[model samples]
Target: MTTQTLDGVTVNTQANVYFDGKCVSHGIALADGTKKSVGVILPSTLTFNTGAPEIMECVAGSCEYKLDGTDNWVKSTPGEKFSIPGNSKFDIRVTESYHYICHFA
Candidate 1:
């Protein structure tokens, strides 16, 4: 199911801007100390490198992502998710907007 709300999270007010502000996100910490990020990507193709494993969950809109070393571009819509390994990178293309939550693992 889609995560419509994050009930108990301490959010960082300052946004993490990337790709010349084409992508932006706010980091949030849950009660149990689980860190996550909620963000939106504008219309652009961006490459992101991960230091830790991450699961990208789409909450609204959609995106097409190509994982490192992969030839296919997979579509992620609302309620869908994709995983990226630690120390890896992924390419994402957004035509409209992609609202997502990044779950750290």
Candidate 2:
């Protein structure tokens, strides 16, 4: 697997899931109204400026995130997806190293 940084965030990707020997990070939209899929490996902590404005699921690892800077962390573990509005400033604290596949519309 290889780890790369995007927008100041680190993401690790498995080498097998690539195309033409290039790392597969972003995807194209299909005619069936489906956009694409992206895989990410989050570390212990991550801070972001904007994100999806909807309920997102966490397939692996747990995350401690908060929409506001109140020291309150929203726990997001395996089988749990949290709702986060877009354009909301937030910070993510992963209790354990985690990996997830995120789908975009």
The candidate that achieves the highest lDDT relative to the unseen native structure = 1
Q: Model 1, residue 58: displacement in angstroms?
A: 0.2
lDDT of each: 0.97, 0.52
Point out where model 2 deviates above 4 Å: 1-31, 103-105
Query: The CA-based lDDT of model 1 is what?
Result: 0.97
lDDT of 2 by residue, 1-105 (tens): 212222333333333343242222444344554543444444545555546554545665566777764778767767675655677767776656555444442
Tell me model 2's lDDT, rounded to 2 decimals. 0.52
Best prediction by TM-score: 1
lDDT of 1 by residue, 9-101 (tens): 999999999999999999999999999999999999999999999999999999999999999999999999999999999999999799999
Candidate 1: where is the Cα deviation over 4 Å? none
